[model samples]
Target: MANQAAPVRSFLQAAAKTEEAPLPLRVVQIEGLAILKIIKHCKECSPDPVTGQLLGLDVGSVLEVTNCFPFPTRDEDEELEAEGANYQLEMMRCLREVNVDNNTVGWYQSTFLWSYQTEDLIETFMNYQENIRRCVCIIYDPSKSNQGVLALKALKLSDSFMELYRNNNFTGEKLREKNFTWVDIFEEIPIKVSNSPLISCVMTQLETDSPVNQCDYDRLQLSSTPYLERNLEFLVGCMDALSKEQQELQFHYRILARQQAQQQAWLQKRRAENMARKAAGEEPLPEEDPSNPIFKQNPEPSRLNSFLITNQIANHCNQINGAVGQNFSRLYLTKALHEN
Candidate 1:
C-alpha cells in the first residue's frame, strides 16, 4: 500500500505545482469506445438519470477516460447499499486483475434538457473530490444527441469552493470573502474523443460495407418545430421555477431583516432601563447577551436550486435560438428557389 501511495502522492504534488503555474488543465481525452458505451447506457436509461463510474489515468493535465460501467438505480435500503458497494469493489478488483485502468478518476451521469446542475450532483462531486484530489463529473445529454449532436461535458468543483464546502461554511460573509458564485462552483473541462489508428481502419471497413449512407445531407429533412417547441416549453418551466425560488429567497431576507430590527429595539430598551436603575442608586440589571436562546439564528437557504434552474433556462434558450435560426435559413432558401 505504501508503494502505491508514494506514486500517487508524487503525482498530486506535480499536479498542484502545475495548478500554481499560469497554465490550466483544460483537455480531457475519452476513448471513442467509452463514449459510445456511455451514449448507449444513457439511451437505455432514457428520461431517468443514469450514473456510471469512470476508470482512467491522469497524464499530466489531460484526463484519459478509457472505460466505464453503469450503476444500477439506488434504493433507500441499507442492504442494497451494502450490496452495491461490494459489487463495485469486486468489479474494480476484476479490472485490476485484467490489467485495465482500474483507478476511479470520476463518474458520469445522464441529464435531460441540461438539468444536470443540482444539489445532489454537487454533493456527489464533493464526496469524490474528498477521496480523489482531482475528480470530475461527466454529464451526457441524450436529448441533445437526439437532435443530431452529441453533448458530453466534464465538470469539477473549483478549488476555492471545494475548501468552503469541506469546512461546511456557506455563510454570506464567507461566500463574499471567497468571491464564490454559482458559476464558479463547477468548472467545465473541454473533452476530446480519440480513436486509435486500428479502430479508425475498422470503422472505415464497416462504413464501406454499409448499403445506405447515413450522411446524405441533400435529402435531409428541415422540420424542427417539435424540437423547438420542446425547448421553449422547458425554458418556460425553468423560468417559472427560478422566479419562485427568487421570491422565496427575497422573503427569507425580509424576515431576517425584520428579526434583526426587533432585536436591536429590545437591546436599546434594556440599556435605557439599566441607565434608570443606575441613576436611582441601585445595581443595574445584569446585561443580557443577544446570543441568548431568544435570538435564534436563521439558517441561510441554499441558492443551488435557483442557480441550476437559471443555467437550465439559459441552455434551453440557446437551443431554441439555434433551432429557429435553422428554420429561418430553410425558409429563405425555399423562397429564393420559388422566385428564381
Candidate 2:
C-alpha cells in the first residue's frame, strides 16, 4: 500500500494561495438621514470550512444633515411624528454600523464637528486588497431622506478625491450641462472611496452566474461618392478613353479634307497651261495623254466651275425661272473669266 502524502498544512495555509470563498451578503437597513458606510474586511475563517466570510468593510462614510423641518403640530400629529421618528432611527442605525477609520472625523450640522483620526483603515484595506479575493462596502439610502441630505462631499476620503481628480482631468467643464441621473449620483458623489476596487469586485460577482452585456467602443467609417474605389476608377478611365477617341477622329477628318482640296488645285493648273498652248494653234491634247504635248488639254467646263455663278443665279434668274417653270436651263460664267 502506498504511503499517503503528509497531511497538507492547516486548511488556512492551503487556502492562503487559493481564492477565498465568497462571503454571505448581509444588509443593515437604515432610516432618517442618509449614511455613507465604508468597510474594510480582514482575512478570517468561515463558519464552515468550505465557506468564507467578509470582514472590515467601509460601505460609505459621509453623512448628510439638513435644517429643522416642519412637522404637523395640530391635526396630523400621530402619523407624521411616527414616520419622522422611525426615519431618524434607521439613519442612526446605518451610521453606527458604518466602519470608518478608528480616527475618522465626523462632521456635524455644517462644519467640522468631531474627529476620530483613523489611520488603520487604509492599512487594513491595503492588506485585504493584496490577499482577499473579495472586498466590499455597503451603503443605505432611503428613497426619501431629506432629499439626499447625507450626500457625499468631495473631501471624504483620499481615494474618493483621487477618483474625482482622474475624472475631471481631461473633461471640459464649460460644455457640460447639468445632468442629474443615477450615473451622476454614483460617479460624482464620493459614494465609495475609489470606484476601481468596487468595480473590480462587481465584475467578479458577475462572472459567477450572471450574463454580462459587455460595452465596447466600435469605429465606423464613411466616404463620399468620389472616393469609392471601383466606381471612381471606372468613371475616370471611361472619360479618358472617350476624349482620346474624339481627338483622333477630328484629326482624321481634317487631314482628308485638306488632301482633297490640294488634288483639285493641281488639276486646275494643268488645264490652264494646256489652254494657253492650244490658243496658239497647237492641237488640243487628249484628256489622259499628257505626252501628246502640243494640243490644248482643256475639257468641257465642270459643274463646279460655275460655283460662283450658281450663287448669283438665284438673284439674276429667279424671275425667269419662276415664269419658265422647268425650261430655264442656262449656263452663266464668272464675269472676269468671260472678259479674259
Candidate 3:
C-alpha cells in the first residue's frame, strides 16, 4: 500500500507543479448570517481578540463565505487543546449532517483597529497554507465598526511573499530581487455581504417599522476625542516598535560590514603569501577554501521581523489618517452648534 501511494503522491505533485495558479482573489462574498455572527462575536468580546473558522466554497475569483463559527479560547493546556480539536471536528460533522457547507475556506479574526499584520498572523496563515492551497484571513475591527461602517476586510498573503516565507529566506537580496516589501506582505481583497432572500425581506420589514429619523442622535454625537486619542496612542506605540526594528537591522548591518572587511583583509593576505610560495618554487595554496571557517560566507539575518513591524506601522498610520479627518469635522460641528 505504501509503495503504491508513493507513486500517486509523486504524480499529484508533478501535476500541481505544472498547473497554473488561479487569478488573485477579486472579491469575498460573505453571507449575511456569517457577517452578523462575526459582528456579534467581535462586539461581545470587545477589546479582546477572538477568531473563528470561515466555511465556504472557493470558486473562480470569488470566495463565498456561507457560514462561520468561533474558535474555543483555551490557554496552554494540552488537555484543553485536545478538547478544542475535538470540538472543531464535532462542529464540522454536525454541520455536514445538516447538509451545510462544511468545507474550510479559511478563518476570521477580530482586530483592534486593523492591527492584524503581525508575525503571529503570518505564522497562522502559513499554517493554513500547509493544508490548504489558497485561503484568506478575514479581519473585522470592532472599534472601527462602531462608527457607522463595517470594518471588515479579507486578506490573503501574496504568492511571492509566501514563496519566500516557505523557503524561510527574507534576506535583503532576495526581497530586492523579488521586489517584495511590507506592503506586498498581504493583499486586501474587497468584501461584499451577500444577503439571502429571506434576510432581504426581513431587512425591508425592519426598515419600514424603524423610526424615520433613525440614528441622527448618534450621528451628531461628539464622542470622537477619546477614539482619536486611542488611535493616536496605538500609532505612537507602532512607531516605537518600528524604531526598535530599525535598530536591529542597523545592528545587523554593522556586523555585516565588519565581517566583509575581515574577509577582504584575509583574501589580500592569502594572495601575498601565495606570491611568496611561487617565488620559493613551492606549491601555492588555493586562494579560497570552502572548508575554511574564515572564508565561509556569513548567512544573512532574516528581515521578516522588520517587514512585519513596518506593515503594522503602516496599518496604524492609515487608521489614524482616516480617523483624524472625521474627528476634526465632528469637533468643528460641535463648536458651531454650541455658538448658536
115, model 1: CA deviation in Å? 0.8
lDDT of 1 by residue, 99-176 (tens): 999988899999987777677888888777777757778899887776656778998888887787688776667777
Question: What is the lDDT ranking, best to worst?
Answer: 3, 1, 2
Give the alpha carbon lDDT tens digit for every residue of 1-340 in model 2.
9988987688888766543444332322221222322111101111111111112332333222211111112344457557755654554455457642221122211111111112332233344445433342222212111121232222222343223333442122211332221122111123323234665577678674534322111111111222233323433544564456456556655765665565566567767777987898777554444453333332222221122223223322332332233222111223344678
Tens digits of per-residue lDDT for model 3, 113-170:
7778778898999988888777889899988877766788899998888899889988
The prediction achieving the highest lDDT against the true structure is: 3
What ordering of candidates by TM-score runs from best to worst?
Answer: 3, 1, 2
Residue 138 of model 3, lDDT score = 89
lDDT of each model, Cα atoms only? Answer: 0.80, 0.32, 0.84
On the 0 to 100 scale, the lDDT of residue 3 in model 2 is 88
TM-score for each predicted model, relative to the true structure = 0.83, 0.18, 0.87
